[model samples]
Target: MNLFSEIRGLVLDALAQMQSDGALPEGLSFVNVAVEPPRDAAHGDMATNAAMVLAKPAKMKPRDIADVLAGKLATDERITSAEVAGPGFLNLRLAPAVWQGVLAAVLEKDTDYGRSAMGQGQKVNVEYVSANPTGPLHVGHTRGAVFGDALASLLAYSGHDVTREYYINDGGAQVDVLARSAYERYREANGLSPEIAEGLYPGDYLIPIGEALKEKYGDSLIDKPESEWLEELREFSTEAMMDLIRADLKALGVEMDVFFSEKSLYGTGRIEAALKSLTDKGLIYEGVLEPPKGKKPEDWEPREQTLFKSTEHGDDVDRPVKKSDGSWTYFAPDIAYHYDKVTRGFDALIDVFGADHGGYVKRMKAAVSALSDGTVSLDIKLTQLVKLWKNGEPFKMSKRAGNFVTLRDVVDQVGPDVTRFVMLTRKNDAPLDFDFDKVLEQSRENPVFYVQYAHARVMSVLRRAAEAGIAADDATLTEADLGKIDHASELTVAKKLAEWPRLVEIAARTNEPHRVAFYLYELAGDFHALWNKGNDETQLRFIQDGDVATSQSKIALARAVSVVISAGLGILGVTPAQEMR
Candidate 1:
């Protein structure tokens, strides 16, 4: 149950009455009207802009409208008071039983409590961690992977049919580089002391690909020329790189629903089809783009070529689809890739890219918009850089991923759960510091442990209640007499618990999984505060020594906290610890 929505219904009902009674205009639209919790808790449970939004439209003063709406809202049984706040805002105070009922609702729904229908099962394609299939995934890709996967999960929980996709850059020069790199390793496996050229991949990861190539071809490709073995090696090397990438993602508990290859677009006429649609719409033309401001390339001579009029759709300039030499530009395949996604029947698309790909966002969004006739919405989230820290110093780099730390390196040090949770502790656009020393800490400073500890504490209570022969199953606990839970501290936790459903919708609406992490932190802090309060007041303790009825009622609250924590962690793809280790 969305309490905010329930209260919004009340506001609109009041406005309808005002219109019926002729106190307001006969034809006023409430599209801009909104009801939400005020920034400060003391302002009220929810505040509405009924007056502010309608004042000018109705040709009436805001206070005049708010005063009339307040009187109508006061008759709502759920609202204890309706007051006109500054400049026509209607602040509402719901009855204490309303908050109490919300907690009971959470207990009723259990793990499914916060699941939403906000998305209405819309099809959304989330493309993330589309790293070059040239080496193992690095730490930077880890953040994008976690954020994108969690976002896909969040969207699904909010009722969207989401497809987690990874676009493989397998059609470009990079795959050719992979083939050449593996050739060097293949020669090394033959004990030839192969020379590692300047442009070749020098990482030890290619050693396995070389060995695998041997096992498959058995030295048949050993003495072949570039043209003879390039295609075969490119295909083989890319598959091995993707295998390592998939394994790295699985280690961090990430999985994709689709792996789209750029190579497929090369021979499939998909690029021509996508650009043809644009050309039919007059979005494709032959043009020369202006040199970039202040730092034009030395070869900035104007040459007419096939270009997409991306500037009309907000790109900095018209983008080339084909170079003067007739080969497709790098962006040509990407546009076709996203066009392929749009044609797959997604109602919306979300691409999670590294911050370095920020310059590409506008053109990509433009492509999807053009391809889908502006019907499909594309939300591109760029995850910022991740700086690693260990033992109070910057974490060392990985030879596997060339210049950066690999995902396996991070997951190996702190395990998958910690790595995933820590990566999402910041917004996708906000740079994050992954400290190997801090994330493994058992204290509240570590969010993964803090949230997990709260779940473990609740489990501890349940185990104790079970050992004492107190029936604390959800069915029994839901029926417990919570009338005795009038303690201010206990009720404080109930208020926090009531925010779960609201928080989920908020996080999903914004595509911000970091909000979930922050919410869990706050929720755990509040639960911890209540637990610490039991030290001072004997009656505040969950177990009242010999009273099973009162203890069951109190333990019911603790059990509900665990239920919510477990569900929230589940959304984050983190397993709640049954006990602290």
Candidate 2:
């Protein structure tokens, strides 16, 4: 249950009653009123701006409104006390039974406790990790992957029908380069001295693709010209690289719901259709763009080109759709891809791009905005770079991935669970330094280990309770006399549990799954603190040797923690550790 929302409802009811009784002016809109946790817990359980928000509208002083509202809230059984802290903010103290009830709700709802209906099953498309199908995914793609996957899970948990999508960049000159590179590998497989050109992919990962080509073609096209095999090899090598990319993603526990090929947009009337839609809206036009601010005539020559009136939507400047030579610009296919998403009837779209693509964000949003006629919303999240550190030094490049470390390289050293959690330890837009040594150090500094340790500790308590024959299963715990859990330390954990539903809604609304990870870390810290406190206060111990009834009540609280932890980890695509290694 969302205690915060419930409390806010009570405050709103009090305000409505105040209006009815003429204690305040009528027709005062309570939309701006909010009830949330007080900034400092010492003040109260929750703080509301109901009085301050209504004072001016109600034509009364904030203190006068607060004084009356406080009396009204006092009549509610859930509110123990309501005091005006400062000028107008009302601090509320909830009854102890309210916190106890939160734990019971956690036990009752289990993994579904924090799930939200905020999205109302709206259709959403999340396109992410759309790396070119040229090589194995690198570290940058990993961050995008983790962020995108977690975001998709978060949206799904919040009741959105989310489609996880990957756009393949296979319709460009890069794939031709890939074909030429694979040809060299094929020659190498035929016992020839392959010329590893400077611009071609030189990674040894292509060796297997080369050998596979030899097995299929069997030297039939050994000396054929570029025209004879370029098309065939382009298709072949792109598929092979995609296969490798899929395997890499699988190793990291990522699977896309859709793999949209860039090639399909071309030669299929899709790009033309996308452009025509803009044309019909009078958005597409032939114009000359101004030369870039810092560029010289030698650097850039402005020419008349087919452009989209992106500025009309939100972009800083109009963007080109086609060049002076009548060839489509790089933005053309992307526009078509997003147009496809818009036409597919998604209510919202989210693109998880690398930080390097920051410049494209405004134009992409403009395109989607213009295409969807402002009906569908688009948010582009750029995941910043991740720097890998090992042994107090920058990690070296991977031989398998040629110039960069592959996603497999990181996953191999640390398991998928650790990889996912640590990747989200920082905001997606902030640079993250992932130290291999520090992540696996089994210390509190490592958030992944710390969260897992809390879950595992709860599991250990269950095992001990089971050994003591206290019947600590969920069924027994739900019926336990939770009033026995009256200690201050235990209540702190229950209060943290009460925030889960509110936290989920906030994180989902912000489209920031990193907030979920941060909450899990804080929750783990609270649980760990309570666990440690049990060490000094024998009565606070969960098992309470020889007292089955008191032990069941305490074990119920601990089990509730594991349930929420599992739900949070599930959103992050992390498996909650039942035992620490």
- Clash count of each predicted structure: 0, 0
What's the distance in Å from true for residue 353, model 2?
0.2
How does each model score on lDDT? 0.88, 0.94
Model 2 C-alpha lDDT per residue in residues 461-508, reported as the tens digit of each score? 999987888898898899999998788888889998899899889888
**In lDDT terms, how accurate is model 1?**
0.88
Regions of model 2 farther than 4 Å from truth? none
- Residue-wise lDDT of candidate 1 within 416-513, one digit each (tens)? 88988898899989999988989989998999899989999998989999899999899998888888777878877887887888889999999999
Please estimate how well model 2 matches the true structure, expressed as its whole-model Cα lDDT: 0.94
Question: TM-score winner among the candidates?
Answer: 2
State TM-scores per candidate.
0.97, 0.99
